[model samples]
Structure formats: C-alpha cells, structure tokens
Target: MKTLYKNYINTFKGLSDEIWWLALITFINRAGTMVIPFLSLYLKEDLNFSVSQVGWIMSAFGLGSVVGSWIGGKLTDKIGYYKVMVRSLLATGVLFIALQFLNTFVSLCIGIFIVMMVADAFRPAIFVALNTYSKPENKIRSLTLIRLAINLGFSAGPAIGGMIITGLGYAGLFWVDGITCVLAALVMIKVLNPKKAKVLDELKNDNPVSVYKDHAFLVFFIAMVLFGIVFLQYFSSITIYYKDVHLLSEFEIGLILGMNGFVIFIFEMPLIKWLERTAFTKLWLVFFGAVLTGISFLILNFTSWSGILIIGMLLVTFGEMVAFPFSNAFAIERAKKGNQGEYMALYSISFSVAHIFGHNAGLQLSAGIGFENTWYIITGLAFICAVLLFSLNRRLNNLKKIQL
Candidate 1:
C-alpha cells in the first residue's frame, strides 16, 4: 500500500514553487468565475432581456476576448508577465463591480465587453508565466496542474453561484467574483517579484516572435480552431440537445455537465503522467482524441438511452484530457523563450472564435436540420481536424527537431 501511494505521489513531484503558487492563484480566480456561467440566465430573469439580446451581449464578450488576447500578448512581451497579471486581474475586478450598475442593453453590452477584455487577457499571461517558471520537460505536467485547479474551481463555482443567485441575487454574484479577482491579484503580487529574477531580465531583452510569420504554427492553430468548434458544442449544444431531444430536466443536464469536470479532475493528471512515459507521441494522442470526440457525438444518433449520454460525456472528457494540454505544450515548444506570450495569445484565438462559431452555428444547424444531423456534422468535422492535425504535427515535428 505504501509503495502504491509513493508511486502516486511521485507523479506530481518536481514542479517548481512558482508553478504551485500559480495553481493557487488559478484556483482562487476560477472559483469566483460565476458571472459568465450565469450571465444569460441573469439577463433573462432579472433584467428581462430577450434571448437574442442576451446572445448579442455574450458575443460582445467573445469580441472583447480577441482584442484582450492580442493586447495581453503584446504587453507580456514588453512589460513582463507579473505586471500584466496584476493589472489585468485588478482591472477586471473593478469592471465586474461596475457591471452591476449597467442595466440598459447598450450599457450592459459595453460593460460585458470591457469586463471580458480585461479578464480574458489573463490567459496569455498565465501561459507566459508557466513557461517562464517551469522546465521544458515539466511543461505539460505544469500546464495540467493549473488546468486541474481550474476544473476543480469550476466544479465548485457554479454550485456555489447557484446558491448565491437563489439567496442574494445577481448583484451578489458580481460582488463575490470581483472580490476574488482582487484577492488573486494581491496574492500574485506577493508571490512574484520581477526585479529579483535574472531569467526574466533575459526574456525582457529578447525579441517577440510574430505568429503571423510562422506558417507551420498557423496550420496547427487552424486545426485547433476546427477541433474547438466541435468540442465546444459540449458547452453550447449538448445540454440543449439533452433538454430538447432527450427530454431531460435542467437538473439532469447540469449533472451531466458537472460530470465532465469531475472526470477531468480525477483522470487528467494521472493520464498525462502515464502518457509522458509512453512511446505514443503527442500528435497521435491528439489525433485519437479527436476521433474519440467524434465517436462520442456520433453515438447519440444511434441511441436514445439516457445512460449513453453519460458514456458520451466520459468519452468527450477523456478526449479533452488527452488533447488540450499537449496542444498548449506543442504551441509552447514552437515558441522561443520570450515569444511564449505571442504564441499562446494566437493559439487562444481558437477558443474565442469557437465561442462565436461553435455556439451560434451548432444551435442554428440543430434548429435548421435536426439534432442528430448536427452531431453528424460535428462528428465529420472532428475527423477532418484529426487528419489535418496529424499530418501537420508530423511535418512540424520533423522541421522543428533540427531547429529545437
């Protein structure tokens, strides 16, 4: 028993202290991520906004994310990660507080945009910080650790936010979220001291790599965007399909969605560790993961059994577990030391685009065609992406092996 326990403990050993602190910061911030998860509901219930209005407001958030990502990458290359992290967190916290006062549609749209622009900027800074603090070999595990914290916090956030919404209302949600962001910023300031680090000084002197010129990375990025558009259907379309087609209640759909995070929390770290020891390359894992994701959605067309939905969720969760960390690692590997921020920023544009394309396209297609047909479309797309990403990964790997 002791031997087994030691083996488990060894799986998580060797990450730097900075990575641990960053995990804590991520946990704290994400645990307060109640606003976005419930934004549409709050708009509809409290402010009496129409569905279309709520969607437009949500799109504003996605647009803000694109702008934020671009700026965050640019600034991280200039001023360094610590300053960007602190400023973005504090600024976002203030914006969240301001959001409660903006009741009109136009005002709410502007508020959401500004709030997300500040908040989403945190993503690139996080990748830069991780790459800055961690060793090359430890990069995947380090990224996975932070993702674990995020999933854990997300599991807690919506449940806690539900109670907050029930008791203190939407205003209370904003207040709690804002306070947490400010606290996270304070913790970041205390933990990370830029002036003391020589490595950061060196990075500060290096030139930023332009993602636009990297045609190979651009291909990988496009593949990710395609995969994201399908994978993200779990967020936008899966529950609607559950509610409408399967006739599941809201509570059941929430439970199924909750299951995705729970599975990732339990499985992701250990799986990544195991993969690190194996001969299977990251590209192969990603290819198979995409294939599995397609199969998960395709399964729905064959059966109406609710039990099958759980299986589909598990499959998709595992696919996410396999693909996302390596995708980040691959992007990081392609970047030079000082250019991590730019690569991650450009990489993150995939998610931003997925937000607009995935949700809107998935829903519209489901409405226009049928739910089963929608899944088939996503299934086909996932396969196409898997093939494209696999071929691209091979080509990039050969070229970069000599350069790296």
Candidate 2:
C-alpha cells in the first residue's frame, strides 16, 4: 500500500508551477460547465425543439468552434497565447450570459455559435501555453495533470448542474457558466506573468513545413476527428439515451456522467505515468484506447439494465485516460518541428470538425435509426478510427527509420 501510494504521488513530481496554475484555471472554468451536458435536454424538454433541430444547433456550435480555433491559432502566433487566452475567456463569459436569452431556433443557433466561437478559441492557445510552460520530458504527464483538473471539475459540474436544473432551472446554468468564465480569466490575469516565463526554442528547421502539407499529421488528424465523433456522443446522444431509454432523471443522468470524470480524476495520472515508462509507442496506446472506446459503446447495445451504464462509463473513462493525453503530446511534439500555433490549431480544428459532425450525426441517427442502431454505428466508427491510428503509427515509424 505504501509503495502504491508513493508511485501515485510520483506522477506529479516534475511539472512546473505555471502548469499547475494553468490546470487551476482550467478547473475553475470547467467546473461551471453546467450548460453543455444538459444543453440537448434543455432544448428538447424546455424549449420544445425536435432532435433534428437540436442536432443543427450543436453543429452550429461546432462551426463556431472551428472558426474560433482558426482565429485563435493565428492570433497566438502573432500576439502570443497570453493575450488570446485572456480575451477569449472574457468574451466567452459575456456571451454565455447572453446565450440564455435566445428562445427561437434561429436565435439560439446563432447565439450558441457566437458563444462557442469565443469559448473554444481558448483550446489551442492553452495548448501553446502548455508547450511554453512544461519541460520537454514531462510534457505528456503535464497534459495528464491538466486533464485531471478538467475531470475533477467535470465531476463536480454535472452533479451540481443537475441539482441547479432541478431547483432553479436551466437559466441558472447559464449564469453560473458565465460567472466561472469571468472568474477563470481574472485568475489568469492575477497569476500568470507571461513576460517572466521562458519560452522554449522551436526545433531548428530553416525550412519549416506547413501543417497543411504534413502527410503523417494529416492521417493523425483524420483519426482524431473519428475519435472525437465517437467520444462526443457521451455528451449528446448518450445523455438522451439515459433519459428516454432507461427512464433516468436529470440528476441521475448527471451522476452517471459525473462518474466518468471522477474515475478519470482518480486513475488517469498514474495510468499515464506508468504508460510513459513502458516501451509501448504513444500511437499504439492511442489505438488501444480507441478500441476500448468502441467496446464501451458496443456493450450498451447488450443491456438495458441501468447498471450497465456505470460499466460503459468506466470503459470510456479508461479509454479517455489512455487516449487524450498521449494524443495531445503527439500533436505538441509535431508542432515543435514547425509553427506551434498553426499545428495545434489544426489539431484543435480536427476535434471541432468532429463536433460539427458528431453531435448532429449521432442525434440524427438516434432519431432516425433508433438508439440501439446508433450505438452500433458509433461503435463501428470507433473501430475505424482505431485502424486509422494503427496505420498512422506504422507510417510514422517507417518515416523515422528512413530519416535515420
């Protein structure tokens, strides 16, 4: 027990203070992420929108994210991450508050698009910040630490959000979301002095390669989009499934979702630390993670027992712990060879693109083909994603050998 405890503690030994602060900021922001987990329910039950309409609005949310990621990437390259992060957070805070007022379909779509555009701009900028703040060897662990913070906050967010929805309604969610964004920004301003930080030198390449032209990276990008599509359903269609199929309440659904975060919060850092010390390549780990995610959804098709929900969530949580941090490290490493901001932007955009397709497609499929078939389809996509990542891993290995 002592040995186990010591090993777990060792996982956090080397990350910088800036990285810790970054994680704290992420925690503050994500803890108030009450609106998103329940957004589909809000539109369906409260606003009386159809599933199809909900899909479209979610797609609009993705469109905004794509644009935000692109603009944020460009600005980070030109002005630095510090400015981009502060501005994005502050703007997003105001937009969240404004978002609660829109009731009509067109207005809600536009409002969410604008809010997400501003909000998601923070994604790539923070990635760049991670690069600047972390030591080279500790990069992946640092990513895991930040993810831990996100999950920790997420664990709290949904349970609290469910209670808020039960008591004060969805409007309360919007207010809390907006306030947290503003608070996170203020903390960023008070804590991080970007001027005093040491920026790492990019890998020496007199002729830098554009992210658009990188064949290996393009393959990885496609895989990430597929992964995102499969993973994002937990937020969209899965919640609906929990509600309609299992006849769970909003608070019960929140607990199940919160369970995903809580599992990751406890297990991810140690798991990541152990994985890093192993001989398994990062992409191989990613491939395994993808397979596990596919299986998570596949199991849902087998049982209607609400108990299975916990099991599926556990599988997905472990898959997430294994997949995301390594994927992030891979992207950052690739970015180091060229333009960090642009590379990370494209990376963020891959998930944004997933958002564009994933939420809408999952909901539509659920509405059209029924939830069982939708899970089967999503399970198939997850396997396809795993195959792609496996191919990309081999391709990268071949390229490395050729270079040697």
Candidate 3:
C-alpha cells in the first residue's frame, strides 16, 4: 500500500507551478459547467422543443466553435495566448448569462452559437499555453494533470448542478456558469502573468510547413472527428436515454455522469504515468482506447438494468483516460513541426466539426430508430475510428523509419 501510494504521488513530481495554476483555472471554469450537460434536457423538458430542434441548436454551437477556434488560433499566433485566454473567458461569461433569455428556436440557436464561439476560442490558446509552461518530456503527464482538474471539477459540478436545477431551476445554472467563467478569468489574470512566466522555445523553422498540407495529420484529424462524434453522445443523447429509458431523475443522471469524472480523477494520472513507461506507442494506446469506447456503447444494448449504466460509464471513462491525453500530446508534437497555433487550432476544429455532426446525428438517430439502434451505430463508428487510428499509427512509424 505504501509503495502504491508513493508511486501515485510520484506521478505529479515534475510539472511546473504555471501548469498547476492552469489546471486550477480549468477546474474553476469546468466546475460551473452545469449548462451543457443538461442543455438538451432543458430545451426538451422546459422549452418544449423537439429533439430535432435541440439537435440543430447544438449544431449551431458547433459551427460557432469552428469559427472561434480559427479566430483564436490566428489571434494566438499574432497577439499571444494570454490576451486570447483572458478575453475569451470574460466574453463567454457574459454570453452565458445572456443565453438564459433566449426561448425561441432561432434565438437560442444564435445565442448559443455566439456564446460557444467566444467560449471555444479558449481551447487552442490554452493548448499553446500548455506548450509554453511545460517541459517536452512532461507534456503528456501535464495534459493528464489538467484533465484530472477538469474531471475533479466535473465530478462536483453535475451533482451541484442537479441540485440547482431541482431547487432553483435551470435559470440558476446559467447564472452560476457565467459567474464561474468570470471567476476563472480573474484567477488566470492574477496567477498566470504571461510576462513573468518562462516561455519555452517551440521548434523554429524560418519557412514552416503549413498544417493544411500535412496529409498524415489530416487523416488523424478525420479519426479525431469520428472519435468526438462517438464520445460526445454522453453529453447529449445518453442523458435523455437515462432519463427516459431508465426512468432516472435529473439528480440520478447527474450522479452517473459525475461518476465518469470521479473515476478519472482518482485513476487517470497514475494510469497515464504507468503507460508512459511501457514500450507501447501512444497511437497504439489510442487505438486500444477507441476499441474500449466502442465496447462501452455496445454493452448498453445487452442489458436493461440500470446497473449497466454504471458499468458502461466506467468503461468509457477508462477509454477516455487512455485516449485523450496521448492524443493531445500527439497533436502538440506534430504542431512543433509547423505553426503551433494553426496545428492545434485544426486539432480543436476537428472536434468542433464533430460537434456539428455528432450531437444532431445522435439525437436524430435515437429519435428515429430508437436508442438501441443508435448505440449500435455509435459502436460501429467508434470501431471505424479505431481502425483509422491504427492506420495512422503505422504510417507514422514508417515515416519515422524513413527519416532515420
């Protein structure tokens, strides 16, 4: 037990103080993320929108994210990540509050689009900041550390969010979410003073290769989009599935979702640390993670018992712990070869694109064919994504050998 405890503690030994502060900021922001998880339910239950309408609004959110990520990437390269991060957070906070007032379909779509555009700009900027703050060797672990903060906050957020929804109603969620975004920005300004922090030099090329022309990366981009599509359902269609199919309450649904975060918080860092020491390549780990995610959804079709929900969530959580940090590290490493901001932005864009397709597709499929069929379709997509990643891994290995 002592040896196990010491090993877990050792996983956190080398990250910089700035990285810790970044993680704290992420925690503050994400802990208040009560809205997104329950947004579909809000539209359906409170606003009386159809599943199709809710899907379109979610798609608009994705469209905004793509635009935001592009603009953020360009701005990060020109003006610096610090300015982008602070402004994005502040603007997003205000937008969240404003978002509460929109009731009609068109208005909510536009409102959410605007809010997400401002909000997602933070994604690539933060990635660039991570590059600045962390040593190359510790990058994946640093990503995992930040993810741990996100999950820790997420674990707390949903339970609290559920209570707020029950006691104060959905409007309360908007107010709290907005306030937290503002608070996180303030914390970032106070602690992560860009001028005072040490900046690592990224790979320098006088004539850097454009990310657009990187064919291998483009394949990986496609795979990421597929992965995002399969994974994002947990936030959208799956919540409704829990509520409608299993007859679970909002708070119960929140607890199940919160469990995903709690599991990651306890185990992900140590898992990543151990995996890093093994001979298995990062891409191989990602492929395995994808397979596990597929299985998580596939198993849902086999059982009607609510206990199955817990088991499914556990499987997906472990898959996420294995997949996301390494995938992020891979993107960061590839970005080193070209324009870092652009590469990372495209990386973020893949998810945005997935958002454009994933949520709507999941909801529509579930509404039309039923949740069982939707799970089967999602399972198939996940496996396809795994196959794509495996191919990408082989290609990368071949390229490395050629370079040698």
Give the TM-scores of the predictions, in the order they appear: 0.89, 0.98, 0.98
Candidate 2 lDDT over residue span 234-324, tens digit each = 9899999999999999999999989989989879998898899999888999999999999999999897788989999999999989999
Better of 2 and 3 by TM-score: 3
> lDDT of all predictions, in order shown?
0.80, 0.92, 0.92
Error of 1 at 372 (Å): 2.9
Off by over 4 Å in 3: none
> How do the residues 333-400 of candidate 3 rate in per-residue lDDT, one tens digit apiece?
88977888899999999999988999999999999999999999999999999999999899889989
If the candidates were sorted by their TM-score against the true structure, best first, what order would they fall in?
3, 2, 1
lDDT of 1: 0.80
Best by TM-score: 3
Model 2 TM-score (2 dp): 0.98
The residue pairs found clashing in candidate 3 are none
Off by over 4 Å in 2: 198-206
lDDT tens digits, residue span 1-404, model 1: 79967776777898888888899999899888866666765776689976556656767777787788888888887787888999999998888888999999999878887888888888898898888888777889999999988878777776677677767888998998899899999998887676653232124425655778888788888788888888877765676677667887544555676677777887788889999899877777878788888889999988888899999988888988898888888887777733777888988877777665776677667767878898999999998899888898688678789898
**Poorly placed runs, candidate 1 (over 4 Å):** 1-3, 40-54, 101-104, 166-171, 196-209, 245-252, 397-404
Q: Each model's RMSD to truth, in Å?
A: 2.9, 1.2, 1.0
Q: Estimate candidate 3's alpha-carbon lDDT, on a 0 to 1 scale.
A: 0.92
Sorted on lDDT, best first, the list reads 3, 2, 1
